[model samples]
Target: MDPRSEELAALNALGMLESDEKRVLDGSSLVDRELRDLNAELELVAAELGRLVVPVEPPADMKRRIRAKIRSRGGSKLRSISPLALIAGVGWAAAVALALASIWLWRERASLNQQFNSLREAIAPVTQPTAEKEEKEKPPARNLEEELKKLRGDFESQKTALNTEIEALRKREADANAKVAQLVQEAQAQKERDAAMKLHVATLQSEIWEYRRSVMTIVWDASKDQGALMLDKMPRVESGRDYQLWIIDPQKPDPVSGGVLAVDDKGTAKTTFKSTEDVGDAVKFIVSVEKKGGVPKKEGEVVLKEP
Candidate 1:
């Protein structure tokens, strides 16, 4: 019999009561026949509304704009807002807007019902005959059936327009979701590329070697097991010979063959190579002139050597 019980009953009718609250209300058995009837009527109205209403999606940039606004405010205000809280606020705002639209629609429907009743009242007296003389003199009464048919056609047209709008909104929502997924994939790929570059940069070692008329510069990264060689002003080799690079690791008796190299007519050559064998503790690098195809051993004259 408490006043709060009636308020709780309304919330239950709206399907918004928590499980524990519903259990308590059910156990109390204080809700009278009048309250139960009100709850049932409200539930029926809600069911009818669910059928009439279409699902609506919030604007694609709604969250983005809200976050941007928060960022622009700056300082303690921005720090105070958490992402989850911001998202929840946006959802609450959307719900409020949707509720307002439904209320407006219901009001319009009620107004139309009132107009229909007035129209029926205006036409009722015509059906009940006054004096036969007055009836004949009043001229042919307007066709009420034709008027009702026109109203029904207008209602159908409005319904079709609303359905088309709903379909368009659904398609836009799908497209927005696809675009967000593509952006996420691209971001992940970029992050991987950045990590590789950083690792290569971190492991890099460079040394300059000078001998007689030629100077050779070497840049290598042990993590990649690869390096680049640059020779300046070195005399061209014999017709059947080519330059080869060797990576010497103290752990191995034989130096690893780094690829063969060819220099341009200007006596300047630059080429990159990957060691065939592990060069993790490489102590020295040597460039040798050998037969067109390089040899596994140091079987050629040393053109350059690095400490």
Candidate 2:
């Protein structure tokens, strides 16, 4: 007859009592015969009510309607839950689990009791604190961080795209610069190839015994004082001596050094030379045997002179 005992008896009859709560009611019934009779009576009444009510066929869209109603009433979804929200959802974990257990019980024992479904439906609107809804209800700072993260992702992707474009442009610019340099070099080379040459020729005779059979020819350029010298049957210089050529101008007293010469064993040598000083209108070319490494002045024996 206790109010709490009656409440537990009613909940037990409708299968709404949790396992621990059901155990407590069962233990109380053992000591109190009135509570035991009341529980039995409540169970019989539930069964009779189930049998009396004829099953009503549900509408085709009943499930959709019920789901919409649940959502409007703040039902929470459980899919794709984040770790932090899952941890925060611990409070309602038991409620969701109990809802599942109630689902199994309703399927198995649905025939025995129909009115109990009303009780389950009545409590359905209560415990819906799933992580999804919890996230929505979070503070403004959490929302701000999510916005900032999205902005940062967009900025990084744009930066990478811009860098790729810049690199491509740089490569194109480098290619253009290289092509211009190549064209300039080709133009310079062509200019040099188009220039003309003016040369003068003279063959010198030597009267010295060692140079009698030796033949030396000078191909000179009067304007540049630069030309090639050819020698045949020439005698090799003595030890510690080198053979040097010279250019002479009718106006100047001193001769200009032409350069040194090296001869082969067959007494033949050919080389190009440029005078150390300008020799305008060169009238003479000479060869001298000098100390090793030719001197700046004509300080050696003149073996051959130009006619």
Candidate 3:
């Protein structure tokens, strides 16, 4: 028998090469080397097919009936497979879509996590205290209590020093106020001295005016016996400088001065005088250089005298 036919008979006997395998055999067009290799492999397959006893031949009519049954089963099986295949294909497509969505979500989550970390870093300085504060909170490696005590002592010392300086400043301000008061008193005294000097000057001027008015009323006439009542020419003087006359009595201890008189541009002084005593021979008139106020004593050379 052909090894392929023998192997098919063995597979039929073992119930492994079922109606589907027979249908495959019926549709195949394998030949030559391919057929020979298939037949050799079939022999080996047949050797392992030992579950049932082999029959020499299936009846020709039975083969026909079996082929008809296989066809019918194939059609029904194709119908059965259609819904499951459709469901499996849809399940696979949904699984692939879910996997892609999950991957996209994972990537986006990673990106968001990176952004969150960046924002956290950016806001850290504003949200947290400075490094100096952290160092203050952290205890020193050694002598923590001692260092804190030292700092407290230093702070107290600085506070005391500031208070002392403030007190010294207050004292300096008091000293300045005392000096200002003394200066004010001195200024008041100086103003009083100036006022007193001005009053004295006004009194002296009044006295000089009263003395001159009294002297101008003293009148004396030149006697005809006294060299024909001679009048002489007067000397010239500079601006604001003038000559004055004095009256002296040989009988009195001090001379009585007369009113001040200045010569006009023509160098002439005319005066009318009166005397209490009738005799004018005892009084003599003397001319001397003087300032506008008249001198208390005779100054410069005597310019003229009447005796």
List, in order, the clash count of every candidate structure: 0, 0, 2
Highest TM-score, which number?
2
| Candidate 2: residue 17 Cα off by (Å) | 99
**TM-score of every prediction relative to native:** 0.33, 0.36, 0.23
What lDDT does each candidate get? 0.63, 0.71, 0.49
| Model 2 / residue 47 / CA error / Å | 99
RMSD (Å) per prediction? 27.1, 46.8, 69.0
Measured with C-alpha atoms, the lDDT of residue 68 in candidate 3 is 90
Indicate the TM-score of model 1: 0.33
- The number of clashing residue pairs in model 3 is 2
Deviation of model 2 at 159, angstroms? 75
Tens digit of lDDT per residue, candidate 2, span 152-232?
576567556655655665566677678889999998997664333345555665889978867676667666668766677
Ranking by TM-score: 2, 1, 3
Clashing pairs in 2: none
**227 in model 1: Cα distance from truth in Å?**
1.4
Residue 149, model 3: Cα distance from true site in angstroms: 2.7
**Candidate 1 lDDT over residue span 110-207, tens digit each:** 67667656765786777873587446533322333454456557656755665565556556657767888999999999877645632221111123
Ranking by lDDT: 2, 1, 3
Q: Name the lDDT value of residue 199 in candidate 1.
A: 23
